[model samples]
Target chain A: LAKTTQPISMDSYEGQEVNITCSHNNIATNDYITWYQQFPSQGPRFIIQGYKTKVTNEVASLFIPADRKSSTLSLPRVSLSDTAVYYCLVAHGAGGFKTIFGAGTRLFVKA
Target chain B: DVKVTQSSRYLVKRTGEKVFLECVQDMDHENMFWYRQDPGLGLRLIYFSYDVKMKEKGDIPEGYSVSREKKERFSLILESASTNQTSMYLCASILAGEDSNEQYFGPGTRLTVT
Candidate 1:
């Protein structure tokens, strides 16, 4: 299992882009970088995932360098509703059962 | 959309009480998981099931058990609840063999033991 490290918290103004990066120095070859977002008192929802290069979705974008040791989750034009805890994880396909979620980056989008 | 539903949003129990947290998914997913979330621990997996009657222990499985009697329902059991066990419990499910590692999650159950 690959351990992930992320910033404890971050602050961003509304309409601004927010980028949170995670470090996983021991990522395996079969590991994929995945991100999830959680609101207060709610379960987390998948944001974006990527193996390498860049992957974009409706909610967020995931960027992985060639080394795959670190990944960044980019939120474009963040809103107040984007205030939540974002988790970064490394796991194989459908093998999220073994994934470990460390203390995620708590993003506070202020208006 | 895949919907995962838990039996309760909030639950209160005594220290020695037996607790059962039920989770059901509308999608017929083969993999179901139980996790507990804490202030600083993030989300810790407790147990998971790949198919009915087949289960595996996760990172934190002490004082917890699970049952998967059907394809869409998974249950977490606490034989003897403790105050230390008070936390938000989350349930998730995903289809086996899918290329994506996306797991649909339930709203979560806040369990408090006195």
Candidate 2:
């Protein structure tokens, strides 16, 4: 499993684009980066995932450079409801595996 | 869409009591996992099962056990509940193979042991 580091907290205003970056200096070739969003008292929801380059989805976009050591999650036109804790995780791609989550980046979206 | 349902949204138990957390997934995913979440500590895997009757211990397996009698159901058991066990428990399931990057999670059970 690769270790991931993320900002403890971030603040963004409504209608602004927010990007959260995660660093996995020792990420493995077989590992993949995934992100999840969790509202208070709710389970984390899958946001987006990428191995390299950029992958975009309806809710967010994941950017992974060729180095694959780091990745960024971009959320466009944020709203107050977008406020939540975001987790960046790196783990093996197949079978049953588990990875530890870091102190996720707490994004506080304000009006 | 994958639907993972837990038996309870909230539970209260007394110390030394046995506790069981049930999780069922409709997608028929082969892999099921149990995790506990705390305030400062992020999600910690308690146990995971690859297929029916086959289980693996995760990072924190002490004081916890799991049983996967069928492909769709996985249960987490606490032999004797304690106050320190009061936390949110989450269940997740994923399909087999590399593209199984997305793990669908249930609503989570908030267990309170007094």
Clashes of each: 0, 0
In model 2, state the lDDT of residue A39.
96
User: Model 1 over residues B1-114: C-alpha lDDT tens digits?
Assistant: 679999999999999999999999999999999999999889999999999999999999999999999999999999999999999999999888876888889999999999
lDDT of 1 by residue, A1-111 (tens): 899999999999999999999999999988878899999999999888899999998888888999999999999999999999999998865556587888899999988
What's model 1's lDDT at B112?
A: 95
TM-score per candidate, chains pooled: 0.98, 0.96
The stretch of ten residues in a row with the least summed lDDT in candidate 2 chain B is B94-103
Q: Interface root mean square deviation for model 2, in Å?
A: 1.6
True contacts kept of 1: 0.70
Docking class of 2: medium
Clash pairs detected, candidate 1 = none
Candidate 1 residue runs with Cα over 4 Å from true position: none
Which residue pairs of candidate 2 clash? Answer: none
